[model samples]
Target: MTDDQTLADTTPPAAHESPAGGVFGDPTAAPLQPPTVRRQWSIADILAEARVPERYARVCLRADLEADHERILTELRTLIDVEGNIIEAEDASLGEETNTARAHRLNDELEQIKADMAKATWWPRFRGMTSDEFAVFNKEHYPKKDGASLEDYNNQLVAATMHEPQVTPDEVAALRKKLGMKAMSNLIVKATEVNTQGGVDVPKSPSSLQNLTRQ
Candidate 1:
């Protein structure tokens, strides 16, 4: 017999005697439903369960780091929008002194924002380790993909979030067309010499928030 079957054969039945009428102690009780079968595991199964703490911590750390990574990407997108707005304003200025002065001020503000972004402590202390420490952590916590190390994954994420535009290429083409038409309209308005009214300041540039890593 198999180990489980041999063990089951030698095991004793429930020690307690059934009550007078039934196990439920009711004389009129219908036959009790068979007890639900519970799962049984051997020594190997118990040993496997012991690894929960280590695995749980690793999973939690990965999830937390991923959350922070997303937050940093969001802040980066805001910075890009601000920069794009400055570009649009400069483009529409058409060499006007007031517009040029405004553009300079915006540029200065953008620089300050960039500095602050660089200074932001987006990751936790554990995640902010030295390069060697990070390598060790990645080796332990993250599995390699297609022969690339953890550092390769990290670099890919950085490049995608920081350097790539958020929108699809098709969407970017459409946005360019829209911007071109808007610019032409601005030029027409300028040529007409009509008194212009200030409009709401909204960031309508192509989004810089695409998850390029998936690509």
Candidate 2:
């Protein structure tokens, strides 16, 4: 069909063509065959030979077996990636739901604690109460009606009575007497002494005395 094929068919043989033998060799001699022509394949031919329908074919069929294998693997990988995305989304949603449930439970506990604290008269000043104000408040622990629950009241009482800043009745009496005194310096001194005995001592200043006297 091609030019070489025509030449192969018609070319005359030279006596010195080959060192091995003439074109007509001994009866058992191997004749020279024409050079092989490389075949060009179409997509249809490639698919027919590939045979992916019935079962997984081995690499021997395709010319570029490695390249073809990578393509197949890439498709499989894409499918796997899609499934993984769906699974990850579900896991994230479940985690968020769990966190929300936990948050609600903690909130309920906090509200219960607040309700309990509401029943006491003078609650611990931890959140907002200052040492100076608490010193004035002393250990006055009582139940309040606003948000105080009975349990909160009981806890407050236990906390208040246990290890309270000891205030002697004598000291209160002395402070009352000192507060009634007309001299500001004397009143300040007495308040200081009362605080010292109560465990959280405050320094008495003459400036405070001057202010009180002016008032």
Candidate 3:
């Protein structure tokens, strides 16, 4: 045989070619994609993801009732000295009957004050919403009247935010009646603060940290 013909006869086929002359690999096959990377969350990221921010406030429905309670406590202290001894007048002018009557009256007043106090104090808890939720809430509830002043809009917003408490309308109404406008407004302020600020102690920013560490 001729040298060129002999070489051609002995030559191996291309790696990608089949014995029957068809291509061994599919050229139309999709290219291999990079592997997906699993995200590694930091402690702060995990905390933020899991956290449901909340704020709490103690509201005094009746300041006068608290003052009355303190006053009664003082009077009781005077009637019975620090050592638990009853003090008597020099002339016994204030007789046993008078002292007993005074003691009974003070006890009754103190009992009444305690009863009033049970209804006078409230610990209202407020929860902050996610940004998406707050955006939707603002869109749905924010005042958009043509003639509404800034103060009117703010008041409406605060009221809407405070009403987020999961109570019935009747319960809210009763609380409002007892709290008066001033106390109710204060609650609204607290609610707004929590909702907007997240009511959490945030880690200091890098700039603030640098400032704190400066000599």
Assess each prediction's global lDDT (C-alpha) against the native: 0.35, 0.34, 0.58
Error of 1 at 180 (Å): 32
Q: What is the RMSD, in Å, between candidate 3 and the native fold over all Cα? A: 32.3
**lDDT of residue 141 for candidate 1:** 42
Quality of model 1 by C-alpha lDDT: 0.35
Order of all candidates by TM-score, from best down to worst?
A: 3, 2, 1
Q: What TM-score does model 1 achieve against the real structure? A: 0.17
Q: Show model 2 residue runs off by greater than 4 Å.
A: 1-97, 123-215
Provide the global lDDT of candidate 3 against the true structure. Answer: 0.58
Predicted candidate 3 versus true structure: per-residue lDDT over 33-152, tens digit per residue? 645986887999977776556766667767778778888888877777778766655555633555546767898999988888777677777666667777887776555764433333
Model 2 worst lDDT run, 10 consecutive residues = 51-60
| Cα lDDT tens digits for candidate 1, 68-141 | 55554554454355546422343455555554355565556656555554564222111123345435644654
TM-score of each: 0.17, 0.17, 0.43
Q: How many clashing pairs per prediction, in order?
A: 2, 12, 0
User: Which candidate comes out best when scored by TM-score?
Assistant: 3
Best by lDDT: 3
Worst ten-residue run, lDDT, model 1?
52-61
